[model samples]
Target: MKKLPHYQAGVAVVTALLLTTLAITIVASLFWQQQVQVRSIENQRLQLQKKWVLRGALDWARLILREDGRGSNVDHLKEAWATPLAETRLDEYVENGRADTEASDATLSGQITDAQSRFNINNLSTDGVINPKEVIAFERLLTNIKLDPSLAAATATAVANSQTKKTTAPSGPSIVTSAASASSVADTSTATVTNTTDASKSASNTGQASTDAIPEVQFLRFTQIDDVLSVPGFTSDMLLKLRDFVTVLPHATPINVNTASAEVLSARIAALSLSDAAAIIASRDRAEFFGLTDFKQRFPDKLTDVSANDLSFATNYFIVAGKIKLGRSTLNFSALIERIKIDTKIIWIREL
Candidate 1:
């Protein structure tokens, strides 16, 4: 009986050890899981914080643009909006006037680019019709940039065809009949009237409004250069090179002579050589063109072939890019702003 008690004691000790081992494993697993959850929450918090900071930066940029628009009609490199912010810490923006304290360790830097200084791709069409002149100018730009000029026609044709597919009436018996009847109209005026009627009927059938009644037919606008991926012959490499000198805007934007590069100026004027473009840029620095007359005097008979509607001394569109780094996370913000009269509005914002 005494030997049986000793054996029972041994069994009790083994059971106690096994229970303790299981308890330790459960506790360790719970602790590890808690740590993982805390880390995930911290990462999400940081991401949210980064987004807020970028939004604040965008607001700041819009304020600057508004102030600039109120002060001057012309947007030049010398303007305050044109100035690039250096990489700065979040603490510097604090009202306490103390750096390296209180605020989190975040760095930011950004620049505002003039979107109107470059050629607008939307200008290739006026009211959905391909402009042969604009196509030729684009060809000249491609030639100047040492790319294949034939790509211009290919790009234009693609854009035009895409637009036509969107707006053109489908081939049908009624469409054929209308087309034939409209073709039979003898005089130009009668033909115009007949075509307008058919267009209205076609628009009604498609459930789209007829733009013919409007004085100006709205051309398609592209918000980003990447939107041109559908264009034929516009490879990524071609877009990269074209990006520096071309822009896609919601409306037809004229080239700003004060801000345009030599290539743009040369392409804009059929007769202007590279040396002439350089001269115009240099002269503008001395005395900026206050009016079209001043522009004429500066370039003298140089831009006779260029239309007055093709040039502008002021800009209305601007792009603001902001970068924010918080903790281990970084955020990039890009905004497109438009200045109408004295009011400035953000057209769109993109985060990268």
Candidate 2:
């Protein structure tokens, strides 16, 4: 090679350094891009897994309904159902090679109910007032269940407030207070008056002092459950606790002792503990309770407050909650069901 000038040699070195830098930059960029692509793929896979798990939950719910002979009435949105599971069991269900036998153990739950029974608090306003009887009965129901007294008071106030019309400005201050003011004062003075009045009226009408009398009043329906949050002592935790077993329906249908879970039955009858109620359910699952008489026969002393005439084995309403978990993903699903005697026909089916 011919001898190069000093400036030419410097230019050659600079060009080589730039080429090396460019090559390194390109390699680094490719590596980063590959990592981003991998993360994106993983995210997509996780989403797919979650979707599949939800589908699995639906399938599990369907199976439970079908087995219970209540599959035909799975359309109602207020029915009650539940299944709890461990995380390890959920992982096994998501895996392909695992036996389907343990699939039931994968956290799944479901419920069904008639929508009409519950009072939708959202519907009530300063204009539309709830029935006084309904308010009293609801409060009594809460009290019977040993819910926080403050919550019950708050619920009554919310309902009353919802229906109360805004008072017109007084034409002039006078000795006689306005009707609205008087009513407000009265409500504050006698919070329990409504319950007492209802009990007396019920006793008068039926000629029997019965604990079941309160249930006869039209109940708050599905949408109304949300209104409970407005009640004074009702916390998010309280609402969650009550959500599983209760329903607001257009009709005041009695809860079926046969199908009602221990949590619910215990709420209805004070003497029944959750454990004792569960034992009763387990026993009845093997054989249907013939009647309240039979129930009394089983636990004569245990069921002191509840009578045979007050109980029913036939259930018209149910709730089912379904949860499915696959891999790291999970889905929660709920449905209300009504038991109707009719020819079987499918109505609506959602995959996820």
Candidate 3:
């Protein structure tokens, strides 16, 4: 049969199948793209919600700190702010339906620590000048931590240099050279070489104009305990050892006797031994020092002579850290709070 040319019939069926397959593929791709967009939006919503919940937690901590300040003048581990908040469900803050029940599981836990518990590195210097006594204390701290005691001088120097703004000569020989050359009308290649040489000579003898000679080194300002690494002798291991016993505050502050560790107390008091510091801490545990007089009286026979100038029984700085776990995601947050006369201020907040 001239019957419907068999080849053409087969071609038509093949063409139809190809068209159907392509259409199905395009439809599936469109669906996938739409699903991805939906998930992206949901993820953004979840991030926003989580941040809000964290903010609320920080606010709660602020309130607690304020109340603590109002109730007492001293900061100790037995206080309410020191008590950690256990991991508690946060369903009221975030819905558990976004993810499977397992994924939706949410909880939060946190605690506030007295920042003054450690020796504030800022204490090493006063008004841009290193304090000899403070430096000695820092030296002791380094020695106690098994780190090179010499780092104390370096740290103090760094802090001192950063705090004291000193006039520095202009940097960049090239820039100085170029400026010097620009002063002369030397357009020729030969003149360019001569000009650069002359500029180098001028720069060698305070060549950069008085205007250019400004404070060039306001070196790196240390804001945290980790900044100690910037010093030449400090290593990560040394920092780990010093971290619990050291701190960096905005200004010079006395070490808190009620909260300071034995290492810190020993470092603060030149005559005090490590064992004596520990004994003082043990005695403090039995009863928190309500005042400087109280702290001295409560300690053993030797501690009565301890200088109260560099010692404090009260705390003004605190660090609050917490974690919020929502199913597959976890948010770790930290903040520094300053308490001023029954009122507290949030110095800084960060996500860890």
Name the top TM-score candidate: 3
- Write candidate 2's Cα lDDT for 1-352 as tens digits: 8989999999999999999999999999999999999878765766676566656655554455555554432222223333333333554444533365644333433344433223223322223354454344344445545675345445545654544345577696445368898787678658668788887898899888566645223333224355576555677877776665455433345446656666556555566767777888788767656667777788887777774433555544444445555434556655444444432222233334
Clash count list over all predictions:
0, 58, 0
Question: So what's the TM-score on candidate 1?
Answer: 0.74
Residue 95 CA error for candidate 2 (Å)?
Answer: 8.2
| C-alpha lDDT of all candidate models, in order | 0.78, 0.54, 0.82
Model 3: ten consecutive residues of lowest lDDT: 207-216
How much is 40 displaced in model 3, in angstroms?
A: 1.4
Q: Which one is best on lDDT?
A: 3
Rate residue 100 of model 3 by lDDT. 47
Candidate 2: C-alpha RMSD after superposition: 16.4
lDDT of 3 at 187: 55
For candidate 3, write residues 171-235 as lDDT tens digits: 95444356557565345557889987888888879746543546556776778878888888788
Residue-pair clashes, model 2: 58
Q: lDDT per residue, candidate 1, 1-352, as tens digits?
A: 4455888989999999999999999999999999999889878887877777777887888788888878876766777888899989876542322255456667889999888888888788755578898888888888888888887776776556435333566885433356656666446658788998998889889999646565434334455877676766678887898888988777777888878888888888789877888898898777677666778876777967666788887888888888887767778888888887667888888886
